[model samples]
Target: MKFTLNTRKVLEFNRILNPLQNCLRMLVSKHELISLFTLFFLVYNLNMRSIISGDTLPTSLLPFCILEHRCVNLDSFGAYIETINNPYMFRQIDGHYLSQYPIVTPLIITPLYLVTYILLKISSCPIDMFNPSFQSIVLLMEKLSASSIASLSCIFVYLSIKNLTNKKIGIISALIYGFGTDTWTISSQALWQHGTVELLLAAMIYITIKNELLENKLNYVFLGFLSGLYILNRPSDSILALPVILYIFLKMNKENIKWFFALVIISGSFLLIYNIYYFGNFLGGYSSLSDGMELNMEVLSRLVGLLFSPSRGLFIYTPVFLFSVFGYLTIKDLPNEKLRFLLYALGLACILEIMVYSIFFWWWGGHCYGPRYLTGILPVLAIYLGLYMNKVSKEPNRYFKFLIFGLIGVFIIWSLFVQFVGAFYYPMGNWDSKPNVDENPQRLWDWNDTQIMRSFHAGPYAYDSRWILLFHHGFGNIYNKITKISNY
Candidate 1:
């Protein structure tokens, strides 16, 4: 005899919209879904997919010295860091800047560098193991570097929120910031200064925190040093602190003038030196330099979209963060709260928006969908919005909050999976041979005028009827398979 289902089971069954279940809600039948995963699974089944896939190349080599791996004695930014750790004989003798990469990144990645350096030293391994241009070593270094920055950013986000709210709220904020999809993805890659947004936010928050810096005096002096580095990386970072500067002026009245002057002197010194040293000018590193830039209008347009209305005013970067807009404004329980946060966050957004408009080349989505340069701003934006989402969900049923942010977390995890899988897939020669389909793998590459080949999007190959092409390398028909999956 059939038994009646309980109310609990009924409710559980009704709420069967889990992410795993969602994945199963396919556009095709069960057999077809099996076919699809089977196809994907086969592509990734190869034991050493990453080796065949050239995706890990960037991770293996540093991008300093105008983007070459081992052009010696160029005084490049990366060479600077390597010199510090490895003691390059010629660069030290030459006293050059080409030997160094940006100190900002080296400073951030120091822990990893130091550890890697020590391990190599202790093991008596060659220093090439720590060289950023050494692909295998560099890739490992880059991944560790990315993880460190991500963890650091997560810690800072937690502290920033915790400074403003309760520990519970801080934990919530930290989790969101740490696990948000974009932050996780960007942080997982060996992107440069990708943690700058966190640093920028920290500076903004510190400056905005009433008289914290000015009253403390010494902290303001140090912040000045940071401010210089901050401005050097992205001038727009300075704008993030303006609201706090204005707050000090308004609150401290006449006394704030000294504070402002001191702040300016400190920030100016670094920028002054950066310009003098990098480009042999005190005020014209990027502000006045114009040369062979591949300025693309489309890339610039997308860069402007980070906070513009077309991006739904920042929600596109973090869809789960749509709720954060209100929390960001409302969390400031005092007039100062609203004044400082709205002005600082919004102020930073405004300046970044302007810079995006002004700069044409060196932008993302020009060649890749995930713009590498803008990643510096992405973490903070994601953290700010993610924290806001967590905050709002508190008033609603905690379960609902959990459900919403939980889904957000799930989405973030999915994105993370994509990044993680993508991160390692190419180096592994990923492939699957389960479907029993036989086809030449030559379609994966496109011949160019320069004689050097590159991968083309799958559809173009299919349209051109070159899916099989001539000689294939690793996998058979991966391009067609991926293109077909993407079409759906």
Candidate 2:
């Protein structure tokens, strides 16, 4: 009787599908189906598989950073709070503790923490909130916050490129933005400011593109709000949005300008209030951090290392971005001068971001993977890639088509391999292993032992990939042997 009922349901489902098969085929192309699968592939791996393997702030400091952890109450002593070193929290002048990082990211994900806490309590779980396992729960929350926003960023990339070019180009743009770039390795890994900033930046680009096609006052208002959130997430990386802001300014009339300014002022006012309350300054926590950093020859050297060094270079991690050079060269072929100007302005903004990172003391982006500072500008580069794809598709030569696409395929494979290995396979602190060079006192910069190569060696050597160790001296020994370094 059960078999008969199952057979009837299967037959009914097939009968329904048989009538709609042709309609479904017509509505969804094979290419679109493949593209959607690719989108899901990138999003799932980048988010779910990229959780912390070691020494990540999201795991170690996020609970305290968000004020979720506190000293145990007498009534619930040893049951509710776990006493730990609290490495990332700083005591305020008034004796209250806050994270050294800005509050925007923790604030954004607070509700997730609340929900997780509620679920834990409802289940009558006998877990301490400060146990190492508790961080795993918050990490799940981090994955949801980062991945969901990142998925939205990818969709906006598709929509922006589709409006500017075609669906194929849009799909490729989103893939490149989500997977074939540092956006995958860094932004999708945790609830970092860079990931949130990337989402906001992507939204800004999409809105900017939409406003260009059809002027909308509300768009500018939203852009203003996003700009504020962008700064709050990461103050320095906010430069990534300047091009869009300038483009908006260039197109606005008196009435539109008034609307934009009104929203901008409101957003700015919130930032000021948040800052004054926390850090006793209108500029916020970043104001305390801005002093005593300057540019020099050493800074220039670190900049080169960040861009071209074998281990840390942005291009090495995501080779698909090399197409961005062509993106600049082919601007004349763009549909209009306004779009071309937008590209130029955005390019300058990217350069400005690099310069900002260069001047900073720790140019290597401490304890993370691959040029993490540039995550915000990656969507801009993806647009450039869309332009490159658009240009090559228009060419008439068959050999040129084969050669260009073949090259792109190779680079895309390399990027996917790097990101996948970086997410799940590579040791978190594998690169920071050498003795201090005279040039770098912190031993963070390594030019020859690229992270890709380190990952290859990590598994074979049974390296300490554990997330809990304060330092892995074995990696340092391995680095010395590989780099053949003596006393400097």
Candidate 3:
């Protein structure tokens, strides 16, 4: 009778815990949840956000302006603008100052700003842009929002690769994309358009691969929308859209194709109206900047600089991507015919991106770290890396496999270290503006005065002490007070 009673009790206990156990399993198994946890881990590990560009200054403010002032123009921020005097980032349109960069990024991140605005209102925290506390809040929100978008890109990167190969390859490639590329140092740091562009591009690739695996009309529609946004985000890189359009046209059914075109037209119409309203032109505020872009023999030097220069070179900053060259050379050996063709199309896009940027007057991308212009093509490079990894995993010769993996490990560590400097120690030495890189373009190629070397000499924590103290103290106090209350 005693044994029977104990067995019944154990059975009852298990029955009571079954729901909790299943919930835990579901959470662990979900890819998105894992990605979110990874994002938080990266954010917590850094514990600092670097606002490194004047280009993103207007974007940081536009979201708050849209929510509070109910206007796109930066008239309310006139005092702040006057203080900063960043002429290149803003333009006077219709007698009102507005962001010169694409407005879509600001609009995308407006919700986060809205949430911050609401919380401040609830807590009676003064919402002044000039106030240190308010400024800290804005900076925190920018980091979180940008990091979140970058994380989303990594998620898609993993999914795309997983679909192409296997789970191990997917996870490894995603980590490389998330940490070893500019996605970590640049896109996750501030409200740069690159983060949004990356997310859109990664999603496009994921959807393309998913569609190839299982045909779906909805995939075409999503691809079309992303394509429209991608072009709008960076019009100069519109050449990157060729592969996507080709894929849609060739693979999608007539009805799906019609839907795709309709979505693209709709997104285009939105841009058209916004541009016409603000700048009185379809090209929007970028028209003046585009005038300087020309194809010339001088582009050859830029092509070399963009590839190999110490300051702005893609390969210099992120050497892990060099494996992508091997991946491209072995493209013909890929078993999936559709994926192989897609990779070829992407290769063409990457080539065109390099050629187009090389012709631009500001090919070094001005006052930024490490090949910012080449950031858009990183997703393609990451996929290629994944391809190489997949091939390496299947190599029959253990010795050769060990040698290749060892080489990749070295590159990965170096890439991560370079990005670490960019995220934490950039601009500490004032390398960009000491002589102004634009005025002294030769500084970019100088091995003795490389941005990486200068940044390292400056040491970590190179940003303003006042801002750092305010962020830590202000948030730290609030956190402690909350803990006290919860304990009570």
Give the best candidate by lDDT.
Answer: 3
lDDT of 2 by residue, 1-488 (tens): 99999999999999999879966666566556444644654555532444552333433344443443542111222223235354343334354444456666665556556655554544443344455444455455566566656776777777778877898898878887777776666666666777778778878888878887887888989988777777666778877777776776688577777777677777667666767776788656577556636777888887776677666678888888898888777777877666678888888889888888888777776656677777878888888888888989988998998899899989989988887667665654355544333245334444455667776567532322332231233233344544553443
- What TM-score does each of the candidates earn? 0.55, 0.78, 0.88
C-alpha root-mean-square deviation, each candidate: 15.2, 11.6, 6.3
Deviating ranges (above 4 Å) for candidate 2: 1-50, 53-86, 89-91, 111-118, 124-128, 131-133, 433-448, 460-488
- Tell me the tens digit of each residue's lDDT in model 3 across 1-488: 99999999999999989989998768767755475547634752373655557788788888878888888888887766777754678887667988998887887789877766765655556656788787777677777778878888888888888887788898888888888888877788888888898888889989988888788888878888888878887787778888888888777488999989888877777777888888888768877766778788889999999989999999999999999999887779867787788889999999999998898878998888789889888888998899899999999999999999999999999998888787778867888888899999999899999998898799885454545775577656656655676899
Model 3: runs farther than 4 Å from truth?
1-37, 40-47, 462-488
Better of 1 and 2 by TM-score: 2
What is the TM-score ranking, best to worst? 3, 2, 1
The candidate that wins on TM-score is 3
Model 1 gets an lDDT of: 0.43
Stretch of 10 with least lDDT, candidate 3? 36-45
- Per-candidate clashes, comma-separated: 32, 1, 0
Global lDDT scores for all candidate models: 0.43, 0.66, 0.82
Q: Could you tell me the lDDT of residue 479 within candidate 2?
A: 46
- Candidate 2 matches the true fold with a TM-score of 0.78
